[model samples]
Target chain A: MDHSGISVLFEGTNFERLLGGLWVTVKIAAVALIVGLILGIILGVLRTFKNRPLRVLLRLYLEFFRIVPTVVLLFLFYYILPRQLNFNLPGDQLATLVFALWVAAEMSDIVRGALISVPQHQRESGKAIGLNRYQLYRYVLIPQAISLEIPATINLATRVIKTTSLLMLISVMDVINIGQQIIEANNHTHPTGVFWVYGLIFLFYFLIDYPLSWWAKRLEKKRLERANG
Target chain B: MKKKSFTRIIAAVSVFAALLLVLTGCGNAKKSSSQSNNPSSVQQIKKNGTIRIAVFGDLPPYGWVNKDGKRVGYDVTLAHQVAKDLGVKVKFVQVNANNRVDALNSNKVDLVLANFTVTPERKQVIDFAKPYMKVSVGVVSPKNKAITKASQLKGKNLIVTKGTTAENYFTSKQPNVNLLKFDSKTQQFNALKNGRGVALADDNSYLYAWSKDNPSYTVGIKSIGPKSYISPAVKKGNKSLLNWTNKEINKLTKQRFFVKDYNTQLKPYFGKEVKPSDIVLPVK
Candidate 1:
């Protein structure tokens, strides 16, 4: 079998192409994660407020994102969103927007659950110290809630990174798009290039995601150790 | 407690409603405007340095990868020339048949060079340049026992790519035939190869390409329906780009570039079955 094609992947142009795609993946995931975290925290906090209206609204928002598939959401944003909304956003930006929506819903549920899991004693102590509800949250609640939130946030981060691969479906040309380009480029040389190309993509995705997941697991373990101590 | 909770819920609903309104505004600005422009706007072409041409990478003969690992085909060659004539570099993007019109309207690609046929229904979404390549639908089956006529497929399973003319024709013309739908040629071809379907229907040029290596399979029938010509597709209202492309194709046509293109890229499979004049039609 001719292995010369493999050399170009490591050498000049193909290497740059690969790196460019990886960068898009990173940028998409990072934006999604940051945006998702902020939105998640807000929703999570609202969900915990003992108000019936907030609870129902949060429930509806969470269910919409939770039940809808990310790929469908990506298409809805990329294709239908522009036509229906009368605004034209580029594909990459739209991918980020849709992914943020998905990540926010998932992350919010995690944040809500984790924040509630923090001891009721913490809230009681804040109230006893003449802390206003806002001050109690600012000084007493958020810091501890964050510790509980980190593992779930990290989990959401890993998911966003993986899910960004779906951006390829909407024409964002991330790592999977590069893989398809490589496969299409090599089809004349190899009849079954898609198999190898997609296999390599799986490897590329795993290389990025596996470490994040492992790191999250390690962080969780350390937090658990600290908590027990 | 209930009153405070009710106010917070209303706040949340209002925020979501505002977001929906913003999204709808964006969508309206980008939809349907692809339809009103006609082909005279050379100035607009000059402003855009890159011409986006959509091709179906999985579809062979028209646009596919060859043995050298480069995308080369009749449509790719034609697109390059069209871009060169417009004084812009060509950027080929893959789009499936169903999404080709949306890609044009959404500004994803400047024009679709995929094996797109001119159809009355599709005209509502995108504009068509003059015909640069003529096409006919055909069925492919095992060479040894290929189905030779429409009736031969009467009781047999026929695989067709979804949203293609093949699917459109077969469903209307041969309703009794067991029609299998796939989104890509890759799957349909595989299904045909594996005996899941007795034959596959698609553009004749593509069916010819698939039948080439699998001497086991042959394009058993030809010219199964009305003759249709392939054209470059553009956004609906961009008359300038459309006109420019038509003029360029006219020049290419006179030089027999499309004929040469067919021979170089398509002839290996078709072997002189295609006529040169049939490549580009009178500017209609």
Candidate 2:
């Protein structure tokens, strides 16, 4: 309710700094999402192969990432990796890589689920039409699988955006970190600044995620309508 | 029907926003009016019958949570003494380096004795009582890669706890050094021990004390910047509380209260390698 605290956001470079931080968050999430999508598709497709050992290996890889906390993973890559490999890795780069690996694991599961959800008869029908395995997947299985995967992948993108907040802990100067710095600097002047500053950050994240969520819901509705009709 | 749903959603969002503003406004109104009405008079604290003091919840020897779950440290002890002098019950609110000033300014705590160092930037926001301790920023590193001079940090990775004087020093004075900021003293030291950085820059007292227990590291750089004083902070206009705090500090200094605190709480960690006088501020 104190406009004084809320006003601090617009003063001088404070709002600009927050925007810069948001850009960093968006950039990291975008890079991680793109990388995750590519890796996920490859891993997901491989996971569907009939070979037991290969499938088990992919399953283990997915489980490992799912089991570990993102913060610990970020630390391992940022601090431990540099020591072990004898190289300097920036915190932001390591954060991006860790988030990408995490997203890849989640996305792979989504991909595998979507692929498996395609009825077996569809693939069999492709074969009955004299289509080879590659053409069958390209013409029939992949197209149907894509429709199922899109909504979930969009959801995953929103999750990635939210998870970028964790990068602040590793000192990446993301939106959350900048917000903290701004509050730290100005909280004394406007005693109620913590509420307003954090509320704005909440808004920033909501603005980014709400549209994606809406799109996912719309896609789900369309998919349901097509299925029902 | 679609347009109706859309309008409903907008209405819901606006109502939520208005509710948030009202809630925040009420909270802010309560805090501001309390301080503004009495601004800095010790009478308010006396009337409340409790003096709320903020001290660090981590950062051992200065302030920390002990195994018994009690907040105990030199600063906490000093705060207790100040409360006793004021004839009010002591209420300890845990704060860290980053939030201590905010806690004071917001009236969340009546005084901040969390090993708060007086800095020019901070002085603008809050008033400090007479200093009770003197500290200097220093560098700690493994013996093999010890840093002795500022020049030695050139192109090297330096770890510092966020919001500390060490971070401020490195940012302005040794800008060439690659600085890694962690949230706490524990994390900063852990990063140093893990070889994530070549050297750790922090208060000399803490670095010296930690190095004594960990033989692999040494306090290679005794003092990086000018000595800074640790004092109790209050809201900027709280003259009565500020004056009382300064007078109590002067009295405590005369009584050598911190010297005793050093002997009991700090000596065990720092040992004779650091003297009681080295860390305690003089009475003058």
Candidate 3:
């Protein structure tokens, strides 16, 4: 009614509150991404080793995380599993764990793709120079494979941030939740403020995600040029 | 390259579809997926010297955490009264709408005092006591061109909260109305204010509060569909708690307890926009 709906987001502690919510979202996503990258590389390495049971297990892990929805996994790990396992798992910690696992499964596939894309001759040349398995990975395979993975990984980071929006459903107070809170707090004065509040939220996400996406494209171009050279 | 992108799009669409199904609970993984039949009855609660009552952690007026970070709302004040009458300390378990039924059936809480509306589907699983408040779908629109009847909104865009009685009523009974469904009431009102829809439909109690705040809009259609009541739900067949809650509700209604509760707990948040008799069940 006042036509100052957008001002509501900038009013009082509402802006600061929304920023805090974004901090929570980014903090959780960064932890998950870091952990996912580490586990992903490990699994991607393990994927190369042709062991039957281990392969079967890896396949199952990938499929389980990939196939089952993240929302279900959150419920399973957060609520149901703790009761069955007879232990206490806090909601934020469990949310991070689920997101970490999901990111790991996703990143591992990228790892597999990048590693596979590395020409077989690169391995032969490394071996011809008498590089051991560890040194070969450190110097030749990993360095080359990383270029392909970096852009994809950055893209996945944005995806991870987007998915963390779901954290609030489990009552985790992510950025979206904070927007809702601000709207609720000002529901009386700015009943129409939800439009601007959520619009700001969308802008916050776009601001974070768009730059990373642009950076990813630039990195991909540089990597392709380097590869062709 | 064209064929390859087409396949990828198909894959992405199917995965999205699967997520939609699972998220909407078609996979039988409902928020209230617990199949427990246990309901902590009055005797069990009193013997334990505490009564566990589930309430909303964020829905103000009915139930929500106040500025002091303490849970206090309309339902909460009544919960305190219920516990005091039963002579037991109260434990408030925070629950959203999705988990209220599960919290009760899983024996995590003895009673659910959230602004839970009575529905035939919910009645099959959980036993509802006598209602303490009345509600119906109300549509709010800009004052200049208000939607005064359900027929006026027959073919227009109407915003409603997903999973609410209004959504159910429109989708089932009035199929012609195009619904712009959102997740929360705040969003629904915001959608209407932003001109996404001609009117927004939700519980009349909250709609009145919203209309009062945003004077440019009005609840042109204050009531729609059959009248509904908000009630406490216990696990099915928990006769002791059910009967006790019914009697407790009846006594409170007779003594006009909720009116006082409304004056103190809800009035501040709702302001003068909402009246005690408007929300509280009438003495009969």
Per-prediction TM-score, chain B alone: 0.66, 0.73, 0.77
TM-score of each: 0.76, 0.49, 0.67
Among all candidates shown, the one with the greatest TM-score? 1
Question: How many residue pairs clash in all the candidates, one count each?
Answer: 32, 2, 0
Given the true complex, what DockQ would model 1 score? 0.27
| Candidate 2: docking tier | incorrect
How do all the candidates rank in terms of TM-score, highest first? 1, 3, 2
Tens digit of lDDT per residue, candidate 1, span A19-52? 6788899998888778777877777776887879
Error of 2 at B7 (Å): 54
Instruction: Report the candidate with higher TM-score, 1 versus 3.
Output: 1
User: Distance (Å) between predicted and true CA of B126, model 3?
Assistant: 3.4
User: B80-195, model 3: which lDDT tens digit per residue?
Assistant: 99999999999876667787776555455789899998989999989999999888888889999988888998889999999888899899999999999999866887788789
Residue range A1-229, candidate 3, lDDT tens digits: 5558888877766787788889999889999989888878877765665567866877888999999998888877655654444333345666887898899898888887888788999989999998766666778888889998999899889999999988865657688876766676556666688899899999999999999999999999998898699
Clashing pairs in 2: A1-B25, B40-B238
Give fnat, all candidates.
Answer: 0.19, 0.00, 0.01
- Residue A90 accuracy (lDDT) in model 1: 71
When 1 and 2 are scored with TM-score, the better candidate is: 1
| Model 3 / residue A85 / CA error / Å | 6.7
Per-residue alpha-carbon lDDT of candidate 1 for residues B1-284, written as tens digits (9 for 90 to 100): 54455556647765885688576665655453553332125664555576777887655567764434456778888888877877877777777666788787766677888878888988887899888877788888887787889998888899999988889899898899999899898899888878898889997876665566566777777668888978888889888778877888788878778778877877775544444554445433
